[model samples]
Target: MNAPAPPPAPRPAKPLFPEEPAERHTLSVTVDNEAGVLGRIVGLFSARGYNIESLTVADVSPDHAVSRITIVTTGPRRVIDQIHAQLERLVPVHSVTDLTEAGPHVERELALVKVAGTGEKRVEALRLADIFRARPVDTTTSSFIFEVSGSTSKVDQFIALMREVGLVEVARTGVAAMARGKDPA
Candidate 1:
């Protein structure tokens, strides 16, 4: 019978990076289309030292009373939860969605890549663009502007390849993501 079975051995604390590698998530926030509101949202991230890989904002309402912001970031599950909680607390925010956890979603970005070259370089660039399904939006004898829309990784790969060919400038539309199926977010 036990000399009062000495208190069971204390449990050890759990390790931080437990199993899975950190995951990247996309968040869509709906907020009032008022001045400084964007700043506040960004400030929240900055103040907390969180990194935003991509951010895109647009007024979606016809009345211009509401704006939608899509943000992409990477972190642990717990950290992502914290970000959602904080975003919900913002006064101007009407809704916050963690697309990664909110079921199926579709994410895409548009990029305008400019490359400058001549002869074989230019021809090769066009060939590569065609392979990537990128369309030439502008063209001159010495340069071309290609418009491409796809996943972030696709855009990144295209840009990297373009750099090797002769990347001059690049403008990306960040990321625009939305939940799939009948549900709306």
Candidate 2:
């Protein structure tokens, strides 16, 4: 007689809540140009333990009645969605757009990088800056302050290269992002 086959191995159970990978997000928030608006917005992030990687604010309206805030943060998808929802509920906020999810967008940042050196280091710094298209906005006998503007990543790479040559100080303007198409973000 043939032996009975053993019971098939049981399949592994799936997790109740699957872990979602964290991702970087760029958010554009339009709001009334009023006092304390920025403070309140920043408070929300602080209360929730969320970190703001980069932030830039400006009055985007010709009438100066409206302002735009661009923020870069990192978190899970769920958290990011919750943040968007919460921001919309605030009284000052007019609209909250997730640029990262809104399709093609343009992001740019300006950086002032100062390099101090003499001899070969100075020559190398100027050479690298020329390659990166960074113009010398201020130049002295010993140092040069170069202004570079581009995507955040490009600015970062330029700063890194400057550090190798003779980077001394750096000032960044955070990030300004906008949707690529006709739609406003």
Candidate 3:
């Protein structure tokens, strides 16, 4: 007697990573300021093996119950769209905007660079900082703290240049971005 064929093995779940062209995008997410919400958002990115280039979060509303998160990542355009869609579906996320795809967006980052040097090296550091328009937030005989705000690429370039002079420490505030025009996201 021919036994009834067992049901075909269930297909494996599809991978979260999609096959698509690599592209850079900035996403602005509005979410409830509740415990574990940030963890869930980050977990979604990590579980899928996606890379986050920069991430920043802050409470923007007067009520302090809502937070805005800005995340920069690189992936295929299709993948980015899928990520946005998935993020939108999250329970805590109130809105998700792909600032890269959104028209006329502005992004900025702030970095505090510390250079420790003596004599000529210190002089050169100051000279270079002046060229970059980095203000001296603090100063000592052997070190200078420079505060610079600009695009990520600009901050990277500044850091690279400072390395040659005597970069001792660095702290960066990840990307903060918003769409242009009167419309609020």
What TM-score quantifies how close candidate 3 is to the native fold?
0.88
Question: Lowest-lDDT window of 10 residues in candidate 3?
Answer: 12-21
Instruction: Give the per-residue Cα lDDT of candidate 1 at 74.
Output: 83
Stretches of model 1 off by over 4 angstroms after superposition: 1-20
Off by over 4 Å in 3: 1-19
lDDT of model 2 at position 133: 94
TM-score of 2: 0.89
Across 18-67, the per-residue lDDT of candidate 3 in tens digits comes to 56669999999999999998998899999877789999999999999999
**In candidate 2, which residue ranges exceed 4 Å CA deviation?**
1-18
How close is each model in CA RMSD to the real structure?
A: 4.3, 6.6, 3.8
Question: Per-residue lDDT for 1-185 in model 1, tens only?
Answer: 65776798889999665775678999999999999999998999999877799999999999999999999988888778889999999999999999988888999999999999998999999999999999999999999999999999999999999998899999999999999988797
Stronger candidate by lDDT (1 vs 2) = 1
Clashing pairs in 1: none
**Which candidate number has the best lDDT?**
1
Q: Which run of 10 residues does model 1 get worst, by summed lDDT?
A: 14-23
TM-score comparison, 2 vs 3, better candidate:
2
- The lDDT per prediction is 0.94, 0.93, 0.92
